[model samples]
Target: MLDVEKSVLYVAFGSLAEITIDQFRELAMGLENSGVHFLWVMRIPFEDEFLNEFEERVKGRGVLVKNQWVDQVEILRHGSVSGLMSHCGWNSVLESICESVPLLGFPITADQYWNARMVEDYYGVGVKVLTDTGSVRGFFSSECIANKVKELMNVECVKGKEIRENVKKLKGRGAAARSAMEEGGSSWDALDMFIDQLIFGKKKK
Candidate 1:
């Protein structure tokens, strides 16, 4: 990652999420075409020959981790990692915000859609891969992935610059959150009160 010139894109979906082989192929090709350095943590259990060939084709430009665990937070915190290709799970979103890594969200299901919307629309710290109809749901082709990946990774572009700026600001909020959990802070006081109540029961007014 240190050897990469600009910054590496880190890719991961949550543990249980799954995509069809076709979707996986499109995603892989899209990442390859985007012309960015990427590290993809592939957890989907599928036996496909294309996976090997794809890895060979990408070579130094991309790396795919098969059936393994990587420290996502550590990767986001690394200096060389500029963006995340994520499922937009709440935890992943929070981790990216805390680490100040911009997101390129490909939401799968459930709360992921809402989280992705918040990251892209509410916070402006990231972009969601959109379908042909401009909806985040529905089918995403290789072209869509390529465009969104390029959009998020290209800091010189207006939208990308805005996303990066937003992320920088959100990083400050993340710091404030950490401080609030520390001694003498509001979160700390709240926790202390809760613990006291749990231990001794609430006193009558």
Candidate 2:
């Protein structure tokens, strides 16, 4: 699933609809440089014939590139995982919050920018990676990837602790929000009143 063993890094790229090779490489290099064990699921860049290039690289590093769908929940909660390289999609974001897992935001899609903004700006939960080229597709250096990954991991050490605390503070607000929409909550009451006014006014007219 998440491969939570200490120093083990599990990366999910295809989990979300979109991701950048540029971002992925940066993280891979980061983890490798920091002496962390890595599991990266990269989309085979070319056809079956070209896949050999990726295989050779994986072989060289003593790493495995798997495409098997992983149970992210089990892995994130497992305690061996130090951080996630995610696109900050809503589902992924919620899981990280629930599991108290750390994140490195490599977001690159619609609404993902807003999700990343919410995390880094208000939640204090993750770090956003900035690309030098800014192109959706570009040649990226693995060295840069490694450095950013190292930074995200180091920063996550403290921010993760803070996020857990924030969870406790926000859970109450979440419950209140739910309550406001239930059978007898604020939203329910408002809907009831509007229906009554509309029916009575129609009869009067």
Candidate 3:
């Protein structure tokens, strides 16, 4: 379904997000309104019937994967996936960073809010959706979702450019950290120290 190269927005709400039906509809509408190509991973209990009309409306531009387990890392690494709309789970955030893709954070609960803040505030790699007034987990309007998606994907926008640059730099740092675990590197030295401590304890026994 993701045929285009670097042209699709990839969306998933992790494994535990409890989205109300209304909120789901709003997200569907927002994706439609965004006018960008997308690949949405829908969890079970949400039937294709719920989005039949939406699918029909966005036939050529959108692809929906329903009630199926997918290799998220593979899809994120694909050239067709340009951005991620995620629940800001740490694993998802790191995956996006490693792949050098920007984010559209829709955090639900737990540490997700903090992750979202880090993405937008600390890391400068994403934007968060606004919650409804007077409600902690209330629905955000489709318009807000559409606008944020557009802003994040707009290459000419300052924020978009910053996010791209930030993720690129972060990816480089991650690569260096991984390389540090090789022979004669700092991480290798730390591992050797840990092993020596274990051996010393055994000898004392």
Please list the Cα RMSD from the true structure of every candidate, rounded to 1 decimal place. Answer: 4.2, 7.7, 5.4
Question: 68-111 in candidate 2: lDDT tens per residue?
Answer: 66777776767666666677777677666666666666666777
lDDT of 3 by residue, 78-166 (tens): 98888999999877887788778899999888988888878888889888887656222557899888988888887788988888888
Number of clashing pairs per prediction, in order:
0, 6, 1
Off-target runs (Cα >4 Å) in candidate 3 are 48-50, 132-137, 176-205
Cα displacement (angstroms), candidate 3, residue 125, comes to 0.9
lDDT of 1 by residue, 149-202 (tens): 999999899999999999888877988765675798677788788888888898
The whole-model lDDT of each prediction reads 0.86, 0.59, 0.83
User: Which portions of model 2 miss their true places by more than 4 Å?
Assistant: 1-5, 16-31, 47-65, 133-141, 155-205
Candidate 3 positional error at 180, Å = 11
Clashing pairs in 1: none
Candidate 2: TM-score?
A: 0.60
Error of 3 at 16 (Å): 1.6
Per-residue lDDT, model 2, residue 11, is 66
Better of 1 and 3 by TM-score: 1
